[model samples]
Target: MKIAFYGSSLLSSYWNGAATYYRGILRELAGRGHDIVFYEPDAFDRQQHRDIDPPEWARVVVYDATPEALLRVMDEAADADVVVKASGVGVFDDELIEGVMQRAKPHALRIFWDVDAAATLDEMRSAPAHPIRRALPDLDMVLTYGGGQPVVDAYRGFGARECIPIYNALDPTTHHPVEPDPRFACDLAFLGNRLPDREARVEEFFLKAAALSPEKSFLIGGNGWDSKAMPANVRHRGHVYTAEHNAFNCSPLAVLNVARDSMAHIGFSPATRVFEAAGAAACLITDAWEGIELFLKPDEEVLVARDGQDVAAHLAALTPGRARSIGQAALARVRAEHSYALRGEQVDQILRDRSASITHRQQQMERA
Candidate 1:
């Protein structure tokens, strides 16, 4: 398929999980001979601080953030078999959404790819400022990175003709288990960028856990987290690189996951970290989430933490043998079902089905 994607930074993929998600799935699609042109609007300073260039596997096209430039690419995107208006890209200006879809509607199958589906849905539900609430009718399909069945059903309820969840997939080559780096070795580690709204959750869940376990060393790795006061037991390592992610995961006695507020509200949404931790064969201690059992077996392959106390308890009680058991079990489950190749294939299947349906309906209309 010749597909065009308007997504978040394809250049600086360091801590932006969306970039990592795109790199994993798109690389698999390209491997299968799909022609992919990913359009990135120059709205952020990622280019000035570029990390990884788009691989030869996919073509990268950067558009100026001007309305004219966006419309021009939308017209170009119209020629594609599938054109996707992905969430993020840091530019969800109402005019851009309207312009791109209006141009692409007649010539191509347009999709709204919500990488952060939970957050997007929350925004759309808010009145007046919701960019996509009014635009949903124009899209041919909706794709989500996570939020399994509930998310798919909610998109359908919002009138999407087709809604599919393509969960954040494991890129085995980059994320598989590696020998622990001595410097990153810690009893518990959490990796996520700090944002204002999520600060309270971090303090309650992450920082409190450190305070509770003064005997164990903890590490916090992400950007925008320097200002937050941390307990003495927790070491702050700002902005972990994607290349070093496997080491970060593998080196930890147990990796902790904290969800965004929206995801927490709409259960079944696991962050890309869960898959990465599992793929790296690291034991995971995550805050309680709904529908978690559907992916990783809680108490067997995964441990649920309700509060800082829970996180501390798990850490204190963990034996190397127990942690190893949890890691191995989770890795086995993820490898069997959640690789990027598998996710890419699932998405391709959905696109094929949608195309077939369109062709069939046209044939029926012509015959009638």
Candidate 2:
């Protein structure tokens, strides 16, 4: 199949959290003999801070953030067997969604892949005229990187033809165990770009935990935290690139996963970092959210914290041996059950089944 995906940057993880998820899923899909072309905008300084060169698995087209550029890309994407307009392109999103529906060849399958489904659903609820809400009925399928059943149910309620949740999984080749680096050495490290919905939670879960454990060294990575107040024991390393993520995970005594407000409330939405850390065999501590057991075993493969106090308590009593054991267990579990290879196969089957059903329906109509 020839797949054309319009999404946030695939070459940069600068301010875009979905870069790795795109790389993982699309790379796997390409490995299975599909031709993939990723379209991303040159905006928000992402092109200036690209982490990797254009990859071999997928051809990336970086377009200007202009109407003309969008139209050019739309025309180029018209011949794809599958056309995907992913949420959060950061530019001309409405036009892109409508373009995917209108510009693709009549036989091409259209998909709206929501990397942040919880927030998208909330927007649809508040604004009935949202592009996704209007496009749902005509789209062949809605695929999400997170939000399990809640997202599926919500999209169906919004009149989607079909909805499926394809949870984040480890891309072992891209993210796995690496030697620790002294530059990122700390007792606990949290890496996430600061966003409105997630800043408060980061304060409560990460900063407060650092305060509670004054003796422990903490490291903060990601952009937009230059002026945020933090405990004296915490060190801020703004904007850690994707290339250093493995070292950042491995060097920390334990790594933290803080879900955005919407994702935590909706549940079943595991951030891409969880699998990245797990693949590197880093001890994982995540804020409490529902449906974690579906991915990793609590108390054995991962540590769940209800609040800052729980995080502090876990860190205080954690032994080096225990952390190592948990990290190893997580690595084993993800390798066995949550690798991108498995996810790619699942997605392949879904696409094949939907295509066959569409063919069958067209044949029946012809007979009539």
Candidate 3:
């Protein structure tokens, strides 16, 4: 199958958190012998701050953020077996959605891939007549990065033909354990870009935890967090590169996963950091969210924290050997069931099954 994906920068994780997920799944698909073309906007300063170059597995099309360039990409995208318009493209998303819906080939399976499903559905609920709402039923499938069953049901309620979540998973090739680097060494570490929805949670789960455990060292890594006031025990490393993520995870005694407001509310939504931390065999402590047991077993594979106090308590109680045990359990779990190869295969199976069902129904009608 030839697949065309339009999303955030594939070669840069600068302000594009979805880069790892996109690359992991698409690269695996390419390995399965599917031809893949990734179309990303040339905006967002991603090109300027790119941490990676185009990989050999897929063809990358970097188009100007102009109407003419988009139209050209849309026309080309329609030629593939599947055309995906991912959410948070960071430029002209509304236009891109409309263009894909209007120009895609009749046989192409059109997908609205929502990386931020909770946020998208929240906006839709407040505005029932949003353009994407109107477009959902016409799409072949609605896929999400997170928000498991609730997101699927919400999209189905909106008249979508089908909806499924392609949850974030570890790419062992990219996120396996590495030797700890002194530069990022700390008692606890949290890595996430500062967005409005996540700021309050970061304070609640990260900074407050740092304050409570004043003697313990903490590290914060991501963009847009430099200006925030922090406790003296916490060090902020603005915009840590993707290449350093493994070391960042390993350097910490335990890594933290703080959910954004919408993700926490939606449950089942795990951040990319969770898998990366687990892959690096970092003892993972996460703020409580519903359906979390589906990913990692609480108190066994990962630790669940209710607040800063809870995080502090967990950190205080954890012995070095116990932390290593928990980290190992998480690593084993992700390695067994949550690799990108497995996710890529699941996607391929979904497409194949959906296609077969349609054909079977057509044949039955013809026979009748």
Q: Estimated TM-score per prediction?
A: 0.94, 0.98, 0.96
Ranking 1 against 3 by TM-score, winner:
3
Task: State model 2's lDDT.
Answer: 0.93
Per-residue accuracy of model 3 over 1-368 as CA lDDT, tens digit each: 78888898899999999899998899988888889999999997899988789999999999999989988998887678788899999888888888877777766678899999998898898998886898897898898998978899999988999999999999999999999999999999999999999999999999999999998999999999989999999999999999999999998899999999999998999889899999999999999999989999999999999999999999999888999999999999999988998999998888777767756776888899
| Model 3's TM-score against the true structure | 0.96
Looking at model 1, which ten-residue stretch has the lowest summed lDDT?
A: 99-108
Best by TM-score: 2
Give the backbone clash total of model 1.
Answer: 0
Candidate that would win on lDDT:
2
Clashing pairs in 3: none
Once fitted onto the true fold, the runs of candidate 1 whose alpha carbons sit more than 4 angstroms away are 105-107, 366-368
Using TM-score as the measure, what is the rank order of every candidate, best first?
2, 3, 1
The global Cα lDDT (0 to 1) of model 3 is 0.91
What Cα-based lDDT does every candidate model obtain? Answer: 0.83, 0.93, 0.91
- What is the C-alpha lDDT profile of model 1 across 162-269, one tens digit per residue? 788888868898899999998788999999988765678788788998998889999999887888888898888987878889999999899999988778778878
- Clash count in backbone of candidate 3: 0
Q: After superposition, how far is residue 6 of candidate 1 from its true place, in Å?
A: 0.3
Question: Of the candidates numbered 2 and 3, which has the greater TM-score value?
Answer: 2
Give the range where candidate 2 is weakest over 10 consecutive residues by summed lDDT.
99-108
